[model samples]
Target: LPQTIVDTVVTTWRLEIRFLWIGSQCIIQDDNHDKVIEISCMPQIYGNACLTILASRSSSVTEGFLHERVISNDILCAKLAVKVFDQTAKIAHLIPQRKNVELEPLYRRAWALQERLLSSRKLSFGSLQTRWFCREMDDNTSLKDDSRDGWTFRERKGWEELERFELLGHWIKIDSQTADELSTQWYFLIDTYTSCEMTFEGDRLPAISAIAQRLAPRLGDYHAGLWGRNLLSQLMWTRVNKSKLAKDATPSWTWATAVGHCRYTDNDLTIPAATMLAMLAMTAATAFPTKISGAASAVTLGMSVTATAQAMETVTPCFILATLRCWFTLLKY
Candidate 1:
C-alpha cells in the first residue's frame, strides 16, 4: 500500500471510532429481534445486582451539578463508631446540600424504572444528596442521623404502615411460595411497572419480559399479556381508554392493549373470609372448563348453547332465511 493511502485510511478509522460511542452506559440496540432480547434481559441483570447511579455516569451534566453531587457524597458523621489513638487533620464536616439532590438525567428516562426496582442495592446521586437503597431497608433513606448536626430525621409516614403490614403477614406465614401468592405479587409488580413511561411503544412487551421469565416457572403459562392457567380470572382487566378504541398491537383482552396504568384493588388479595369456604370448594370438579380450538389459538366456550329448529320450508322459508341474515349482521362490530 502507498504511504499516503495508509495515512488517510488511519485518519478515517479514527473518525469512525469517534462516531461509535464507547461510554460505560452506552446501549447498542436497533429495531430487531436482538433489541427485544436486550431490553428483556435488562430486568434480570438489574435484579441480580446493584443499581448504582453516580455523578460520573452523568456526562451531560454541568459543573454546578457535579459540585452539588460532591457535596452530597460527603458524610458528615462517621458510619461506624471509632476509637482514634492518633488524631490527624480531621475532614471538614459540611452539612448536606439538600435532602435529595436532583436525580441524574438518566433517572428521568422511562427505561430506568425497572432497574431502580429490581436492583438489590441502588446508589443514587441526586442534586440535593447521595443515598443508598437496598431491598433490606424498610425505606430508601441511607442517612438517619438528626442528632449529629441537629438534623432531625422524621421518618416517612408510609413506612410505618408498611412495616406493620409486613409484620402481620410474617406472623401469619403468608403463602409466599404458592401459586395464589405469586399471582398477587405479580399483580402489584405489573401495576407499578405499567405506570412508568416507555420511550418506544414497541418495547412494551420486551421491557417487562424479564419479570415474566422469573415467574414463568411458577405462573403456569403466559398467553399474550395474561396467564393461561388463570385465563378466566385474567379476563377481569378493563379498557382504560373508552373514547378511542384499543390499538391492535396487542389483543383487546390483554391489559397491554392500552397505554395506561392498571390496578387490581379489591383492597384484599385473599377471597373474603366469608367466602373462604367457597374458595376451598373450588376443586377441579367444580372448576369451569375452557376449550382450545382452531389453528390461531382461539378459545371457545367449554359448554356451547346448541339450538336447532327444522326450517318450515312449506310455511315461511323466506322469513326464516331473512331472520338468520339479520342475526348475523348484528354480530358485526
Candidate 2:
C-alpha cells in the first residue's frame, strides 16, 4: 500500500471507523478469480460504506494527496475598515468557489466512475480544497454552495434520482415517463463513462460490471452493457471518433467493443414505428420457439423496414443491421 493510503487508514481510525477496505490491501492482486469476485461485489462494498475517501488531487497512487495546496489571491478576501456611528469596524466578504472535480485525475479514471456513483457519502481530498458529497447535500472546506456548475453536482443528482426510483420499484406503474427518465440517465452515464480513461482495454466491461449489476433490478436484463428492455434504443450508440474494434470477445454491436468514446443518439427515448415493429418481431421470434418460422419471416420484414426507417432518419443503417444480427445471434444460445 502507498504511504498516503496508509495515512488515510490511520485517519479513518482516528475518526472511529472500525474498518477500512482498501482495494489493493483487501483483494488478492495476482488471482484473477478472486479479482472477479471482488469486482462483482464493488456495488455492495461502495454503496454500503459510511463514507468513501477519494484522493482527487493525486495523479497516481504514489503521489500523496495530503500535500499543501496553493490558493489563489482571488480566493482570499481583503479586509475593509468602515466607520459606523463614529465607531471603527472591520469586515470582509468572501466568495469561495468550488473547483471542478471532473478535472481531477481520480475522476478521469474509468473504474472510479462507478465508485463515485455508488458511494452514498464521499470525502474528496482535492487539489484546491477538500469537499464532501452525499445524496442530500454537498459542502467544501472553502464553504462553496450547491449552485456550482460541475459534473460532480450533476452526477450526484442523477444518482439521487436513480436511488429514488429504485426505492419505489414501481417503474411499470409510472409508464413511459419514468422509463424515459431512467433511459435518459443511463445514456448520460454511458456518455460520461466512455469518455473516461482505462489502463487495460479488457477492464472495460469488468470495471463497469458493478454499475451494471446495481442498475439491473431497475433496468432489467443486461445484454453486453445494453439493457434488454431498451435494446433497440441502446443499439443506437455511435462512436465519437474513428476507433478500432476491441480485440476481445465483446460483441461488435455494443459500445464496449469500441476503443474510443461512444455516444447515444438524441432520440434514445423516442422509439420509431419501425424499431418498435422490429423489436416486437425479434421478441416474438426468441420468446416463442414454436413460432420461429412465422416470427423469423416477420423478423426479416421488420429488419428491412427498420433499415429503411433508419436510413430515412439519417441513422447508420449498417450499424443498426449489425446490432440486430449480433442480438439475434446471442438470443440463439
Top candidate (TM-score): 2
Pairs in clash, predicted candidate 2: none
Query: Per-candidate TM vs. native?
Result: 0.49, 0.67
Q: How far in Å is the alpha carbon of 83 misplaced in model 1?
A: 23
Q: Over the stretch 1-333, how does candidate 2's per-residue lDDT look in tens digits?
A: 786786678669877999899888898988877887788789789989999988888888877787788765665454456777887764323333323445778868887877777777888787666767665553222334544433354444443344332222222122334544566667777777888898877777777777777667666666666776767667778899776667866556678888779887653233333231232234343342221111012223222113222213333222333222222212112
Q: Please give, for residues 117-212, the per-residue lDDT of candidate 1 as tens digits.
A: 455655554444445555565343455554332323443323223323222232123235676666655565556556556656545555566555
Superposed by TM-score, candidate 1 places the C-alpha of residue 165 at a distance from the truth, in angstroms, of: 14
- Residue pairs clashing in model 1 are 100-128, 101-126, 101-127, 101-128, 101-129, 102-126, 102-127, 102-128, 146-151
| Number of backbone clashes in candidate 1 | 9
What are the Cα lDDT values of the candidates?
A: 0.42, 0.61
